[model samples]
Target: MAVMTSRFADGLAVGTNLVDTAEAAIRQALAGLSGPPDLVCFFICGDDPDDVGRAGQRAMAMVPGAHVIGCSATGVIGAGQGVELQPAVSAWAASLGDTKITTFALETLRADDRFVVVGLPERGSDDQVAILLADPYSFPTDAFIEHSSEALGSLPIIGGLANGLQGRGSVRLFADGEVHEEGAIGVVLGGPVSIGTVVSQGCRPIGPSMVVTRAEDNLLLELAGQPALARLEDIVSALDEDDRELVASGLQIGVAMDEYAERHERGDFLIRGVLGIDPEREAVAIGDVLEVGRTVRFQVRDAETADEDLYELLDAHVERTGRVDGALLFSCNGRGSAMFGSADHDALAVRDTLGPIGVAGFFAAGEVGPVGGHNHVHGFTASILVFSSQAAPAAGA
Candidate 1:
């Protein structure tokens, strides 16, 4: 297990057997606290879906009064490493002296013409931090995020999808010690605590910026008055052998969040995948929305880019906050050994930058975090939430 202690709380993680992992993590976390923790958040993995509830019960039995939230995951993250697609468990507990911690659950339902989300409670009064675990099957995460962006008003919502069943039967989520098979379970934390977040999209800009001269929703008809495919061909001809190969493997579109900036860099772009292309009209269908006049650029991602982006974000976070008490990492399931070609790439990045801090989380089907001031559902991304005890408000550099 790994533990990071601040003024009031401690963060902890452990991985072993199903129930044993939770019990051990809870004991280690509570050992450093002055009293009962105000909140206990956990993510675990087990071959059997029935083990989820038992693991949660084991953890809660150790910490009687703390509000508990947890979910089942494909793999568990903690102890300065990630257990990719393995049986493991990780828990983050906060003592929270006087911080107000409230746990809640929400679900989305089809409302004929639109979807209506139920069980969404009011936001916390102060600048609260939201941690969420959603069911990939039942929840409309994209629509919910767009709605909550307006409702929560910059309140950061960061978490991952439950991968217990990998979108088959009901996956389990935890709220107040109960295991749920549907909906999203979350906890809103406020008062005294400050949180710094870094959602590493793990991509770097490739080509020069261009304006979308014409488009239809997510379909890009033209770029700088040229057919999208023709523009891409031209750009491809200009690249060296390696870059051309990268384009063939993973070419993405980047939409500039702030077009008025004099210069744009890697983080300035909200990167989206190029789903496919229509040669008949030479249009490109991207994973996100597009408009007629928005500025965009091409981007690429591989192991090198992902490493640089994640570490750069982490080192920058440490430079700003100085010290992090605890961290929750929600990494895309596509990451881990698949992208980085090794286990524990994302979790170890945080440990190398922060030096053995408290860290725990899981591999998610889809990750949720802010990209240029708005929360969006992302894939092949690692979104980190770092907790701080500083008097200053939380900021991501």
Candidate 2:
């Protein structure tokens, strides 16, 4: 039996019969598995009242004993294709051999006006990766991530903030045979199975790296001993018309992830949004924390810049490690038609460069991936997990 079962394709048996759709997805996922799968995940998208939940339940029944987890999405990503605002399901099944995959569900409730979270699993020393999905409307995902950071240590969490309907949200998570309309769900992959991550923040570094000469918490007071806003104006004054327009549309700050590098590059910085500027105080507030001594740069992102950045990162991954078994993509919903001008732009890039393998995921409200070896919530980013497969010596005849 193969160590893992890997297959993914878009458009799973479309019809009024939800059972057929569910069964078809199972067949696609298990096509080449010589033995029973160890884990199964299905991400579904549709407007039908119960299509997402029914498909999830029926899909699990088809693969009895397989640990199944998934959720409904505004968009479904499969293979090298992305189906947006449509009725589609993407299923993935795997056999990790000696690897251990544990599933858990979490919900938040108020106690004495304080929000309390339930369902975080204990992490083992050998655990290396986590696949997380949560309802964006109800779950305090950012808080959960912050808490997990200290507890989980360096374990990389890669997934998305569940995207859904408005007005209480159409959030749904599937664990075992049950569908949850609230909270979060995840699978922790322990033992030797590791997740190699590629986080594309979709921005190009503008201007030079400047050290933060003065700052207080998240408020950036000064860069290179100058007012933070003043430094930004200087950078903008030097840009050409198009790039200046890009900055005008929306600008961001890039906190250097690794300061030891001789030349800071695109991937060196963790891009953050500028929340607000205090002109009177000559300071600016960023989404992420800032410190007095940290090096930083101004960054700009547009369709062309984002496209180039994602391609470069994916190409670098392919060159670094030639072997890939499968991948789980957690992309910001803003990236699909909103940023790329079409669907499947990111998926196609991955498949075109690393294809003939399996891939499945959903368009997320916020993508989770690693930057500088730490997991962080990101916007307009594509957080990918590339499953690396090692070669075993051929058996002697």
Candidate 3:
């Protein structure tokens, strides 16, 4: 497959400015290509909601016959900084060899016994992977992940939720040369191509793993027979004032998979945020639903912890894969500048660990990757798909 990537930034003071900038970027990326691309992923960043959609349309018009899928980002990532606020667009086009591209959209994805996987083309092999872009506001992301796995039958799914303006409803998703408001879209690549995935969930576990003695769906009533909130409070109270404050603000919990025999480690647990505390019920509301019997632990997030965990995951993948040709990063919108207090922290890590290959992607509202051997909608995370060159064929027959 041939891959071409380009970014364009213009002083996007108006909608017209955004359209011009995005058109220029798409044109530049496709300048030397012999034919139309099989797939085009466009990532746009801007303050105006209407302008973002217009810019995306302009980009789609430039790349005919390519399946376009993307969304509005918290900030735009490209060859440099300042593109996020300047009405800029970054795009990556792939010309697949001997591979057929199929695109689909699932407007309403609910749990069912035999529901089809959204955003994935119907006619694909078992080896196909579904790359999804979903709207978190309307869809039950957790259930979507679970049921998608069930319906798709081990076909790995990757991508993230389309982010909006703050917590409002201004997000956008692009497909088939148009933008959408509330839905999911994906493309299935079938044929000789092989795709390798890596999810960098930047979090470290703290304390020992404790089993849930009592719980309900989305609420933890007790851990080890103690009230969930009380147990969490005790752990945070023991820390210093600064640590306590950080924990109080961004408190999270880590749930360990029961099938794994080894002790709980950093990546072993799927990290989830603490949604609310039910003082009357003595229960803790977690971002993810919990089963009656499960193993979990209280965890925290900070720059040092996040950086350490990310580096560890990346290093392990590098050692396993040896080397790579290129990489696509779908990072959480909350991570780069919001979590690290600056931009490019995750990108820099990729460059350092993987030796600077062609990298492109957007800052998604909620990241998607495999956690505990299952696909999940993650927060403050980074999911990377690394493309490596296949070994040459053996000597002639």
Candidate 4:
């Protein structure tokens, strides 16, 4: 008798040999599944491009009929642990009953002063989610995400930028069964399976939200009839000593995505860095462009704040949508031991709160996920894609 069921599993292995590590990880994941998976994704963390490519090829060969995709990272997360600065491989496999998977590779073309993304496939009506892995040095991820609505409609994207110690020319992306030196690779999944998204920017707002009275491009000229920098200074002066210390080290600006919302909270704003202040103009520069009438607030981040932010979101996910069948986590490379002073902080949180289920991912250069119904590339964030279990008719009933 034939059966139809959705299943997921993840595994991890660490060693000097990339191929051996990848094979062990894939085998560990495969052992947890009932049958062959429909899709397989692996993350390899190593410095050598040649070795990474070989390991990717071997992973593809191990799962011949399944769609394979992955990229090289500086660290990997799986098996309820995160391994950093080591040669490690993390593999995730899913047998999604009756789901359709389409994979494509995208490249960038320089036309005059602008770069255009080429090879974006037409999106289908049933397409629900897209998993994207791109090279930060070669791909214009920010621009692509900004225009994603025009190209792919409302489909949510969840993935991250591949990272390495040897920046720029060292990125390697894997799709189908091939390794790409430059460009981006992704897979679109459509079917009965349910996918949920979670994006935690790991920042907490510290001041009252104010509307922008004047602005020029990315420069904030005025806020609520006062100089932007001056307003910021006032806010900092009122904060307690700890918060003031946080602001002194580094500060961020959170731009409200929805202007009409009565209240602005943690997840409601898109956070940007407070780049530099122009004392002469009394203006503040941000990482993104801001328009007049937009609401903005000051934000601060630290180890304790980041931990609280992620765990709160994860708990909310469980309460609202039951337990997830599996999850793919894309955490900022700046996190892990650097932020928490301990290893496997994010990975353990996801597994302890929501898991014992399948979960795998890597520490990304930049995380990608939607905030307030819009996709954007973020830093110091943890972007996650959670899959719900699904069932369908037997294949040969």
The digit string of per-residue lDDT tens for model 2 on 258-370 reads 87888898778888998888999988888887767899999989988888888888777766666777777878888888888888798888777766667778888898887
Model 2 segments more than 4 A misplaced: 1-20, 109-114, 391-397
TM-score of each: 0.94, 0.90, 0.84, 0.95
* Candidate 3 pairs with clashing backbones: 119-186
Q: What tens-digit string does per-residue lDDT give for candidate 3 at 175-227?
A: 87868877777776566665567776676565567788888888999898889
Local distance difference test scores for all models: 0.79, 0.77, 0.68, 0.87
Model 3 — which ten-residue stretch has the worst lDDT? 5-14
Best by lDDT: 4
Which wins on TM-score, candidate 2 or candidate 4?
Answer: 4
Model 2 worst lDDT run, 10 consecutive residues? 1-10
**lDDT of each residue in 239-291, candidate 1, tens digit only:** 98988888889788889989899877898888899888899999888998787
Order of quality (TM-score): 4, 1, 2, 3
- Give me the candidate number with maximum TM-score: 4
| Candidates' RMSD to native | 2.1, 4.6, 5.3, 4.5
* Candidate 3 Cα lDDT to native: 0.68
